[model samples]
Target: MDKANQSQQVTELTLAGLTDDPRLKGPLFVLFLLVYFITLAGNLGMVALIRSSSQLQSPMYFFLGNLSLLDACYASVVAPRTLMNLLMEKKTISLVGCAAQLFFFIGFGSTECFLLAAMAYDRYVAICNPLLYQSIMSHRVCVLLVAGSYVLGLLHSLVHTEFAFSLPFCPPAEIDDFYCEIMPVLAVSCSNTQVNRHLILGLGGLVEMVTILAVLVSYSFILSAVSKISSFKGRHKAFSTCTSHLTGVTIFHGSILALNFRPRPTDTLSTDKTFAVFYSLVVPMLNPLIYSFRNREVKSALREFVVWK
Candidate 1:
């Protein structure tokens, strides 16, 4: 078979994207701009709030501040480009631009995965070993965990980005979705992708699964400990501390697992796109809101800021 036939047999990918209708461009651009602003403001506000608040100087809040920073960095990598593409006629990303996007996106994303796991462990110590919470979640330990998350993210991103770019882009370098992603890029590769697919499934899948398992195990112990607490107020406080993290975890993992693990041939591209939005856009925006709006401390701090204003 010829190259064209081979390409068709592999996949009929619309790398530039599905919609080029001028009529839809204006509305889409406005909508994406709104999303970008919200994502940026929400994540940055959370970071600032954590830094400025004396009551939030604890280890848990420290981790949360780091998480907020990660979310902001994660969203910045892809959302601006997506917003611009929605506004412009041509939605082309240069090779170097795409590589940078992939690097930061993967770095922040991987960091977040580990950071969430670290947060879960923090909760585990707080609940399961309340007497030792301070010692276990000491300032030094918290700093190490936060630094580890970023370092791991950087290393993992380096591996994936280097491997991804190793493949030559002979022609037709188009990413189907709004941003640079592994699956879409793999599909566009003219060379054999069996090794790449296997590595992605093994390494990427393992990292996600391990982090999720760690969270689940930590939460299980936390729930057991929570059940033993006799005071209603105590129980409520304990549960509230974790509710935001749990909600964010559910959204992030559920959306990503559903998108990636489903039967590829059976699922539509539209389905993937919707799920991508949840991870790449909505989750970052929601992280701050879910964690901060629901917390009394955060609300009180915001109120004080408003009063001062």
Candidate 2:
């Protein structure tokens, strides 16, 4: 069909759950509910803990609080919808709602990728360039980095959403996997999705690759610097600071790579669902725990607060 005709063809779509088996519904609901609750509590708790603790007033903690907030936001976009689908019979979303989900999912997710890179740089400065750490990461500089990450995220999401919805959808919008994903959305489109698919592959796929590259490059330098530390105790402390950042990076980028760049879509969806669980649910829960609970300062603050309470 021509562009004009395709434009006028259709706009709405029907979505399908990954599995229609009635037997799986109850188990999935219970499992996802538990995951969602832990993710919410872990991320929200980290934000609150950071804010209340005076010792965590540095740029590191500031970035951490933002990271936790993004995790909560990202998980909220996907997890709750997934949970609702399991419980509800209809499992339908409007075109606008789907678009909104796509926008925020990409937005927060892109932001988290950049934020992870920024945090890696922060650790690099603190560990590798200790003398310039404070001077380089001043409050104003920190704010600018965080703002830039969000702006980049917004732009990326806009590009993906615009191209995604431009295609025509005759019917059958049933998105498997409990949320509105781009692949499922494109699958039911009446018009040929070659251009839309290429756009997603070029824009969204390339950006994710770039983000992963940036993260890997930052950590490479971090690892080299950590290895050079003379004292065993000093090296241990340095590596500990990076442990949480590394954990978060591994989960987020690893899942994206698996789901987006896989060899076959049909073969990957089941595995993709598992990757999605890691990215959207498990990672959020683990990020705060890895960072907050492992840090001496946060643990100390928690203890002091407990004693005083």
Candidate 3:
């Protein structure tokens, strides 16, 4: 077949969404709708709270606010489409639409990885070098870090999306996952995808490893500092400050590693989907709850804002 004919043949792809069980659609839709609602409310509420409250003007909350915004964005990219697909008997997505989803999904995800690493570094400075925290983590520095995260994310997504979409895809172009994820979409290509597979492994692995290493190193220093504190109350206080962030790191990295890093049989479609749900849906909702409930200052600011309103 000529290039034009092949392109015409695969102009649109179908999404084999989460499940095909007719009995489960209603319950799953209701459940996913509730989750998406909470994700929006929690993430938007966090961002609004951070922006409105003078008490949250620090670098830590600034990063947290950006993280919240990203959660909302990436969730929106996938959740609405997933919800719509649930209601339709024939779940179809245009080729262009799939590419768009892949781009934004990866862009936001990679940005979040770097942003989380930046947050870890922020915690390290605040805990390990309290005296120098203000000077080192200035407003200008925070802005640059956040900007760099988004920039790197865009570039990373561009490279992967371009390369992935360049491969010729023949018929039976149905993606097994709910969304246009890298691996699942690549699985549909007719051309030789060994290079693309290796790239996914190499590039994706490098990004995750570097960001995770940064978080680990930062926490190592933080733990060392906490251990040296003379008073029991001081140690407890230090640990409390880090607990929420540590929890966030664990959940985010753990889910991604399980999905991407682990060796998988080709038949583990259901398992991959489960991991995707946790990181994409569950973690975003959990992040705001963790930060807001754990931090006294955020609670106080929320209370103050409520009363003022």
Candidate 4:
């Protein structure tokens, strides 16, 4: 049979979920269900708080609000499907469903990376050129940055998704991940995927390098500006303001690094699952706490909003 026919024949795929033990299904489902709720509530609430609070109308919060939105979306792309599959005996997903999941999962994740870099740039401007912060990060500029991030994300995801699904999947149709990740799907293809893997590494690495370089450069400038501040308290305060963004970036990029740089994440299924859970579930729920809840302004805003309500 021709390759197109072989590809067409793959109508659905089975997921080898988090565990095979039937006894553990109930516990796992409950655990992930609770996590999903917290992720949605935390991230969505952050967006609402940022939008409603007059105090949070700064460029920093503008970037943060979008980050919250992206985290919620990124988690949703994996969490709900994971929860559903946990309940089902077969854990089967349609080809289209798998494709959609992978597309959005990669898209949102890539967007978040760019968004974090944008946030770092915002911090740089605020620290390095305080007087020009407002003018430089004008509303128009912020919107354009966000739009560009999404465009880049979509392009990256589209290329990888199309390439992954284009190859004919050899049957059993079982993916080793709970969600349809690109690499796992590619691993199952009948076609020789060495070139595709290399291309993926090249493009993914390029994106990673660009974003990380932006973050590093921005922070280096910020540190330089902070060092010039003579007062100990003043310098401390400046860095304190950035602590949240730094924390969020560290956690997010740390997970990405572990997955990519450790001899490929898929080589060790247990390690892959650990980072997968970290990316798909833990990060979203933690982002609000890391970025906003711990901030003085957001706390005050929340208190005021509560009192008013």
lDDT of each: 0.82, 0.81, 0.90, 0.88
Q: Candidate 1 — which pairs collide?
A: none
Predict model 4's lDDT versus the native: 0.88
The residue-by-residue lDDT of candidate 2 on 90-178, one tens digit each, is 77787888999989998898888888888888888888888989999999999998999999998998988888887666534456666
Candidate 3 CA-lDDT value: 0.90
Task: Report the number of the highest-lDDT candidate.
Answer: 3
lDDT head-to-head 1 vs 3, winner: 3
Q: Count the backbone clashes (under 3 Å) in each candidate.
A: 0, 9, 0, 0
Report how far off residue 264 is in candidate 3 (Å).
1.4
**What is the C-alpha lDDT profile of model 3 across 211-272, one tens digit per residue?**
99999999999989999999999999988888998888888888888878887766377888
List the candidates' TM-scores in order: 0.92, 0.91, 0.96, 0.96
RMSD of 1: 3.6
lDDT of 1 at 250: 90
Determine which window of 10 residues in candidate 4 has minimal summed lDDT.
259-268
- Please give, for residues 111-225, the per-residue lDDT of candidate 4 as tens digits: 9889999999999999898899999999999999999999998899999998888788857779999999888888778888987788788988888889999999999999998
The lowest-lDDT stretch of 10 consecutive residues in candidate 2 is 6-15
Model 4 stretches with alpha carbons more than 4 Å out:
1-7, 264-267
